[model samples]
Target: MAFGSDRRDPYRAVRLKLFVIQVGALLAIWLVLLSIVYVLMSSELYRVLDSELRRSAIQVIQSYDHNHLSTQNANNQSDFGAAYSLWKITGAASSMSATYIDGTPFIDVRTVYHNALMHPSGYSTTLQINGQPYRIFDALVNLRHGTYLIQVDRSVGPTQVTLSSLISTLIIAGMAALILTLVGGLILTARSMKPLLASWRQQQQFIADASHELRTPFAIIRSNLDVLLHHPDHTIESEMTYLGNAYEEVERTSALLENLLTLARADSNEQILNLSPVSLGELARDVVESTRPLAEWQQKTITLNAPENHCMVIGDPARLRQLLLILIDNALRYSDAGACVAITISCDTTSCELRVQDNGAGIPQNLLPRIFDRFVRADPSRHRAEQGSGLGLAIAKWIIEAHKGQVFVQSKEGRGTTFTVIFPS
Candidate 1:
């Protein structure tokens, strides 16, 4: 056996893998959501700013007249606290018609005002003008006298602050949600793996039990063969006892293997029952007769009791037969010689019932619950003595469950044991 250092924990590895996958999916969704919200919010803020600029430009255009270029409406506070520059052009040559500002223009921003007069393109732009954020746009207006150019500059400091606050809030909230998801996902993943971990542990125990059961028969067969090998000079008759022992061990091993295969197929869902309406009373009679020879060999009397009317149930006949054989054979193996083993059957309108009872050393209360578990036998020595593989009851339980029936045992120590089976009609 290896120490802890050599052991790699599969549970931790599997849980971590599942956690990573869940977190990655959530992170991707968060990224997409954040990006979409950011783009939409930024566009909306800019859109409001542009609308205000357009409204201001429209007011400046309407107030202008070729004969008397007016700056009254352009310089008003309702014009969105803006600065404007206007020009008039009759032909190729143009003149600075009017310039308006709600307050005194700073010397640094005088150049921006000058550029508006120098070049006026019909578009909107954002720029850092004179250490302040500004949205600038130029508009073209045609008058009765000539064409006019207007430039508008609006400070965007407040809008910029709102956008920055929105971005910060989104970041903070998203981070908090991501952290919560990480912790929650780890916990949930751990909880989800519990059933799988339990199943894995059971599988490990099952393999260990099968290995232990197989080892004994193999060892016995090898020992008997070794004895035969030692006396090769003797006639075949002289070695009959050793050969017989080996053959018996071989047969026991074959039965063990066959039972293991049946269980494996059952676990994998590869076993399909051929279902039909089976008469339980008729099947019981057939099983009792076939099992009678074994009862005779063991010096026990086997009898069947059933209702006059047929005990009908929907089931697979072959599996039903196997189930009966397993219970009766188990009874014969454990019962004292000449003990009475009885098979009884009864049916009502809704369900059919069967019972196998033996007057023998009964099962202890502690072992009753797990009596049908694989590789579980009350006495290993007695099971081996009777060539029992310890898997018969497990297979019997599987067959009955496949037919959607239930099997249970009732026993009292030193009295007897009875296995009861119920099938829905």
Candidate 2:
């Protein structure tokens, strides 16, 4: 019963594995989203920067052509945060000159201008000059004066700073999101596993109880056989008792196996029943009559009280008979001589009710809650005379539930017990 100490925690392992998978999936998705966002943001930023550089290059060319290459006008044209240069190219006459916003030549202008002149069509490139980053755009313009290569260079320090900040923010946010995802995944895993853990524990307990029940009868049968084999010279009449004992254990084992199979089928939802309208009054009378002889032999009384009207419900007749027999047998087994067991049937407009009440030493309050569980018996010692496979009430409950009905029991330690079953009309 102490599931924690008896076995390993399989549910915990499964939950941890599931949580890891979930967190891993979430992290993957987050990384992909961040990659896409960073790519789009960086691309847009570079696009805007390149556009400004191209505009500045065009302005410089226009100012030079209009001012007839005047240095003053060129200095005024360098208003944006960009450096520009002009290269004149004629047959066997190539010369380059550059200017900056501060009236001083920008560092590495000659190398950049030559690189731009080599690729006449417009292109963008990045350069590191004096340990500062610059984004350069090159354009070739064919003016009336000559073919001019205009190179525009802009400082990328601000853009780099902004991008770095964005990267840092994204990293911080991603870390936070990952932490939250891990926590949520763990919580969800635990929540989802609660029922599964309970079911697993129940299954473990069921298997343990079944094995224990089976081992008893097998041990008895084996012992009886061993005794008989040891007494080989004894006459058949003398060893009849040993053979009979073995046979009884065999019968008990067989019954236990049959009940286990029935429960297994029921649990699997594979036991198809032939549902039909059955009269509760007639069924109760039949059950009482069938069990009357046994009750009388024990000096106990069996009675059936039913309304005059037919109490009909949809169910399998044979299974219902078996259900009733199980309850009656349980009642008789637990009751003493002169105790009364009654089967009462009544109906309302929407449902039919059957109550099996026994004037017996009732079930303990602690066991009452799980009385219908498989292999649960009122008598823990399971005295031989009243011993059963302990599946009768479980089967009875399953049959009632299969018919979309409800079964409940009321019992006290010293008083009697009552089992009530209700089925839709």
Candidate 3:
């Protein structure tokens, strides 16, 4: 059982969901990013190519002199950035220059004539060179001597290869990042839920054990009290005195069981709540009035503070009233004689708040967290003869939580304690 309990397996369904979502989002972002990169890089490449082509065309035209004297001097200039083939005409005669690399001319004689028709403006086209493609830009210029045509070509091979490689890299990196994120998130979620799962199991065990413990003691006490009463010599006063203690313990056990049942019912997700709009002012007034007699018996003063007009909240009225009674009862049990306990109802346009503040020996700091835990008491060693079944605060918390409201406590040792409940609009 221990080995089986400790075995760990991946939560595959949740992990798969996370992986798909993360990867899908990353894939979309990468696609957009790669598209933008492609567009911007392509534009910048074209701009640089345009400038280079214009410069090369100007350099080629300057190679000839005003006398129309062609010089071999242009050959030694090393002006052509890349090997290119060129053809030129002087009157009815023609001359040509070819690179030793034996590459086909990117701009042909026919393209130059087309540029001449267009005049000044350039024309661009692609041509094959040594089985590789190059982009060519040709311009026609009417030089002082004669008509001259200049052309430039740039290799597209390296730029295309680089862009394709980068896109592939980005896609691979995005997918890897997505996988790692899903794995990490799944592990974190499981770790976070571990403590809560342990607590739930402990609560289940506690309920089972507490039920058996309570039943035995109660049954024993009741049987003993009954035997004592069956004797003929037993007096009414003695029976009442002795039997009262046993009867009170039984009531305590009953209250504990009742609280557990209420919590069980409340935990059922299918439990239908009797919901209605309740007046906060009226509820506070009624709870205060009902507990007035108990306050007098305990020699404590009870004060109510609420607006004259109705302040409404949406919830189960019976549950709200029960929660109020629990808070007042808890305050009365701990409050010092003659100390004042105030119940205040404050409201705004959107929500309402109820505060019960008591001038009492405030709860110990360490016990504050478990104040709403079943069967947990601040002073466990103290006699339960008159103290409650230790379920009032627990019930109050469950009831408030059921209404989608929050309950909180503020306490300072030996100063006072305040319990606040809030209901949304």
Candidate 4:
């Protein structure tokens, strides 16, 4: 079992612990509430029964008349559920007594009368009479020419039944609530862990990719340094080639580290956008003009398509400029020699649209969904040759999303790729 358990998912134990805590807390609260309700209900029911008994005993004593001393019996309980017994004791002798009883067939007459004489003017909160529970009250009254003891008995069977039913209902309800709490706790914990697990896995992937990318430039720098070390006695000009090669690798490494820092700041929400009104058309025009020289040097052409007037949007100008450059760079990198890269900006009252279209070796259909994910590249070999860390599109995506804009890409292998961006105006 130990070996088998060890092979199971580590999260299972943690998840089970959470489930237990959630369900146990809910069950404890339910039991406490149930106990409180039961106590209140039973207390109220018994209080009513006790009050009725006392009231009936008082009424029986008040209706007693000296003029009716010769009356054999008065049936006071003919209209109520309770039974009554009235005894008149004269001179402390058993033979000199008159008794009147009603609806007390289940009671022991002689014993109850004797008890009434001994414990006069009090309540028997619970008394067993012929195998049933009863609430009995006794009152001793002294009037003209007589001493009388009055007894009132009310059965507690109905109250017992109601309390029993209430307890049974609480038990069933508690069980049902426990089941629901278990199921609900499992569902809630699973849902809560989803984003956390995704973030943890993403962080792991980012670290691995960063290490792999960093190792390449470091290896190149080490090789160049090894060459300079071999020619230790040479002049500065003789070893300048090795020094320049090492410097280029250092520059690439610095750029890669800077890009990683920017992404890290973006992920941690530390890179706050400096928002302002900017002209999209003007920005696109400037980026195209500045990048035209590089395109011509690489045997490619660049053009801008936009309205002559302003296409204003709320965004960070610097971030928008970076975003435009990343897309234009990707278009140029992937296009064949002599291919033309086009930038278009248009706007309406509600939204502004920008497009970077290129006739190049476009992305595969299967890779479109996660193309903006960090470290995801369309062609790993080609990107590595161009010193791409595959973070440009990812950074561009973050910039657009931070500015409350949306990006969409449509591409087909060997045909073309068009990136459409929409910014709220």
| lDDT of every model, 2 decimals | 0.79, 0.82, 0.71, 0.81
Ranking under TM-score, best-scoring first? 4, 1, 2, 3
RMSD of each: 5.5, 5.6, 9.3, 6.1
Give candidate 2's error at residue 295 in angstroms. Answer: 3.3
Model 1, 228: alpha-carbon shift in Å? 1.1
Order of models, best lDDT first: 2, 4, 1, 3
lDDT of 1 by residue, 58-172 (tens): 7766655523333444354334677766555344433333433333333233344355445554567788877887887766666675666666777888888998998899999
TM-score of model 4 relative to the true fold?
A: 0.78
What are the clashing pairs of model 4? none
Clash count (model 4, backbone only): 0
| Candidate 1 ranges with C-alpha deviation above 4 Å | 1-15, 47-70, 73-125, 135-154, 191-196, 303-312, 342-352, 381-383
| Model 4 misplaced stretches (Cα beyond 4 Å) | 1-17, 47-78, 83-153, 383-387
Indicate which candidate wins on TM-score.
Answer: 4
- Per-residue lDDT tens digits of candidate 2, residues 105-157? 44465665566567777889888888989898877678897766677788888
- lDDT (C-alpha) at residue 193 in model 1: 77
lDDT of 4 by residue, 1-425 (tens): 12125343446566667667877888888889999999999999898888888787666666655242224344447235577777665655375454553333444545665776676566566888779998787766676747766678789999999999999998899889888877788787777656765776788899999999889889988998998788788888988888897888888888889999999999899998889999999899889989999999999999999998899999999999999999999999888898999888999999999999999989999999988988888876674557377899999999999989999999999987999999999
Segments of candidate 2 deviating more than 4 angstroms? 1-7, 10-20, 47-132, 135-153, 181-200, 233-238, 267-289, 305-319, 345-352, 400-405, 423-425
Model 3 segments more than 4 A misplaced: 1-196, 212-223, 226-238
lDDT, residue 354, model 3: 94
The 10-residue segment with the lowest total lDDT in model 2: 98-107
CA lDDT of 143 in candidate 4?
Answer: 67
| Leading candidate by lDDT | 2
Q: Relative to the unseen true structure, what is the C-alpha lDDT of residue 239 in candidate 4, on a scale of 0 to 100?
A: 85
Q: Which candidate, 2 or 3, would have the higher lDDT against the true structure? A: 2
